[model samples]
Target: MAEKDQVAARARAVTERFQFGPWSMMTVKSHILKSEGPTRERFESQLELPQVPEMIFADNVLRVIHDDGYGIEFNALDALKCVDAHHDPLKVAVSQAWREARSSCEHINDVVKPFDWTFTTDYKGTLLEKEDKKITVSETTERIDIEKLKVREKILFYEDMLLFEDELADNGTSLLNVRMRVMPSGFFILLRFFMRVDNVMIRVNDTRLHYQAGKNYMLREFSTKDDQVKEIKASQHLFTDPNEIANHLTLRKEVFEKLQFPETPPEEGS
Candidate 1:
């Protein structure tokens, strides 16, 4: 009884609105499919949604509908994981999914439309520190090699917003960190990508996009540490063309692939 009450209280807290620097922010977490248009029919007809199991965990799933026709459709058992385990498994999974989605969106222009996909990240930096003090300086330097270093990533969600972070480091120094956030309802995306080497900024690309009713425009501010910042304005038509919808679907596939967890460095003699 106490657990149930606690979870109910938590749900309220998570759904409540909070003040943010003279603005009010809603924290309602939604799991419904969303698109930038006047109606949900437009989104449904244009996009292909993933087929979630109807009977998850050998039982029927549950749907929670909101007044605005958006809601979370999830397994009752899985939903109970939040209260039973005292942690939000669903939130973690949703965040991971959105992270992949944003990655796909980032690469969409390259694969679908004509655009450059080059990333200007400096590799000459220390990212992780050595634990062993007895190790020689040369050994430490070798351990901090950029190509040999692996990229680390994490995804987190706050209500309706999702944040994805991809970082690469040399030794203990930050080489690059790209942080992206996505809002499902508003079709909004924000990205802050930065690269540094030896504490010197190498490149930065800060971008934000909000898809309006008929047309969508993205603003990108690009810069190098020593160079002046440059702005790029890109726009696209929403929901009017079939080709655009197909391109968006391809982007989703690209991002959704990450959730499948592809094997890294396939084994020999397969």
Candidate 2:
């Protein structure tokens, strides 16, 4: 038993030496850890493989919050080469946290779009006679005073769509989700038409990545609720699937008049 313990310790020492703490920190790291488990144990943070490419890591603080919620930080000095995670146990912890932060930001877009609408209707003054609908013509011949028209301002929003990529974690798939917040620049407008998204869409390299709307991911209330990623959708090639690719068949707007409002939008007119 003593010899065995010595061997193990020696091996660990060799491994640590292999990981060059003396070397320096790496510029950037990134990754996506998808999960399909329960909410409590969902997506395990993953170290961004060399691919995700986060330039910010080169000049930013890497922070990791364990399950306990205590934050652990990794400093990035000018010589960050000391960050070889191969043999360093702490390296994995620190790298995973930074990677998750960067990767998790991908869903900031679809999740933050419009939600509801409010505005004053163009109503003529109330009178004894029934209100007659005014037809909106191309151009009115008579000059109308702008002051006379009722100025009813309204805000509009819709249920947001939380967007994410398909990947696997030990617990479940991690679905990147975000809520729409007011644009700081347009504070006066509030949640009105002046809204601007602080975060943009994550560039999904391949739409061929197969993910079912309800199965792989679900969003009941994008702003206040969490989304569940049920499965890891297999990436499929749309070009090879003749039947699947036909949905994009373009049709003229005139042909779609029979379709309902939400079900189908009129194709753009020529």
Highest lDDT, which number?
Answer: 1
As a TM-score, model 1 comes out at 0.20
Q: How high is each candidate's TM-score? A: 0.20, 0.15
CA error at residue 228 for candidate 2, angstroms = 21
lDDT of 2 by residue, 149-191 (tens): 2244332211111222222221112222212211111101001
lDDT of 1 by residue, 1-270 (tens): 257754653454335443322223333332332233233343234322221111122122222222222222222222222121222222242445323433544333234322111222222111112232111111111111223112332222223232111222221111122222223322222333332222211234333222221221122222222211111111224222222322232111111000000123322332
Model 2: lDDT equals 0.20
- lDDT for model 1, on a 0 to 1 scale? 0.25
List the candidate 2 regions with Cα displacement exceeding 4 Å: 1-91, 94-155, 167-170, 181-270
Collision pairs in model 1: 126-170, 126-172, 126-173, 127-170, 127-171, 127-172, 127-173, 128-171, 128-172
Give the alpha-carbon lDDT of every model: 0.25, 0.20
lDDT for residue 146 in candidate 2, whole number 0-100: 28
